[model samples]
Target: MRSDYFKNTAYVRKTAVSSSIQKLDKKDDELAFAKFFIERLNQFRKLNYRVVSSDEESSGADIYATAENLETLNLQLKTGEPGLERFWGRRRKLGSGMGIIDVNIEDLLAQIIRDSEKHYANKENLTLLITERYQPVFDKNYALRISTMFGNSSFKGIYIVKLPSFRASFPYEGQIVAIKDIFGNHGEVF
Candidate 1:
């Protein structure tokens, strides 16, 4: 089942890339990512949650999730790049001696905040799901920083899902860090 999940994720990612190159809409990608995110959430929290795509235009939520509690959570999904394109060009370079790659977490947070404000109209009961496309180094401190940064935001919860490298055999072997949640908790979900 786990292997099948990874294979499905890989296929969704490939489709997302192809759609991107074709300048087509990424509705399928958004739904697939939402489902994947919910699956991980369910596994980590031991909660049976199901996700469905929302009419973003009317609901201001990319996806909606519901659990046994009958409580619905609106999620605003955002995918971000590692901001390493400038160094490696369009195609990412894989090899040794790549040197240190600096990732500005503050800038990324700022962008997320901006995107949330610009794209979402209703923020009540809304959770932010940011899926980092490439592998970016994030420690507990960074997670704390993220929590602190979005603490006062309109979102009820905020989470970051960092994906593994493209070459990784276990694509789902990544971290899901919660920046903020209903219980006022923060840290790695795993």
Candidate 2:
């Protein structure tokens, strides 16, 4: 329910972060998603941000963008069950660049939050979560609570973009981008 402080959390609270979901096994999805995100950011047509691949032990931020020598971090990726049908009742809250939020999103959200906490603690330079397309497990519960807490900014906190499911195995195809549609329009956030 805390908006302004969602990104600002006490150090004690940050040390206690954990998750149980398996590491994302699909690199194709990772690259595809990262590619799209990078392209989109680059398309902004301003100063360009640099994208860096994972290296040994450095633990550098994922995608770092810069303007006028000012660098920013972007942690864009997927979360929880690939099949979005699992989203039933959940809520998402957004805050400014430096804030603290007490809500949990998905498995990926947990990891991102945890990692960001670590990075910030180490005095690294990183900003912006850009966690759009977050699909909550429930609607009314989190929605009502988030609405009550955030009011007008509630919508800005989350962008419920429609995501099609990804198929693990496709025997009859060379390559395909699998997507599951709720109304067959490929599930755009309504």
Candidate 3:
């Protein structure tokens, strides 16, 4: 009985350690993605955006950016597999492949809606940007979906930026797409 108890305890301990490691890996990936996004955004000569802070624990936003116009772009960076569960407190594994990722529109919208309200309250001309790693595949109906979810809010816009793999690349090109009605106009591509 003593040996069995010890074996079970050992197993539980190992499992807990493994889970903790996985969470740390996810957080590390998120931070890496945030850094990559900031680097790419900075490449645009037209925009002078600065990274205010990159603290992982900051609940407000992963990274905060400000352009020359003094327009604050509160950015939340997420990198993971595609699923609605992602918006509801779940993290998916990021594949190494480089290509367009078909992200869940509803999930992304849900996150934007939740974060914009929670983070960007009272700030005018505030842009609550939710940037996802890799390309997010969305359809024409995405505009309507966003409009329905937005309701009444002070958030000026929600921008989704996708990009190539965060590797030393030969060529790079990316854009930030705004959900049309959610912002009332098209956002600039960086």
Candidate 2 — worst ten consecutive residues by lDDT sum? 173-182
Task: Write down the RMSD of all candidates, one decimal each.
Answer: 11.0, 16.5, 7.6
Model 3 over residues 1-190: C-alpha lDDT tens digits? 9999999999999999999999787666555555555576556434566666556565456556766776666555543235433532232355423333344555556665666567554434444545555433443355445545553446655555555644574344544555532335443344
Give the poorly placed runs of model 3, Cα more than 4 Å off: 45-59, 64-74, 78-81, 84-157, 165-172, 179-186
Question: How do the residues 1-190 of candidate 1 rate in per-residue lDDT, one tens digit apiece?
Answer: 9999999999999999997866435676667667777888889778888997777557878889988766787878777655533333333445521334335556666688677866666765788887765544567776776677766777788787665455655344667778776557775564
Q: Quote each prediction's TM-score.
A: 0.70, 0.35, 0.51
Q: In model 3, which range of ten residues has the least summed lDDT?
A: 83-92
Question: At residue 181, what lDDT does model 1 achieve?
Answer: 68
Q: lDDT values of the candidates? A: 0.70, 0.35, 0.54
For model 1, what is the alpha-carbon lDDT of residue 111?
Answer: 83
Backbone clash tally (model 2):
17
Q: What local lDDT does model 3 show for residue 96?
A: 25
Model 2 C-alpha lDDT per residue in residues 59-132, reported as the tens digit of each score: 53443334456444433333343422223222222323222323443334344445545545432233223233
- Model 3 TM-score is 0.51
Cα misplacement distance, residue 57 of candidate 3 (Å) = 4.8
* Candidates ranked, most accurate by TM-score first: 1, 3, 2
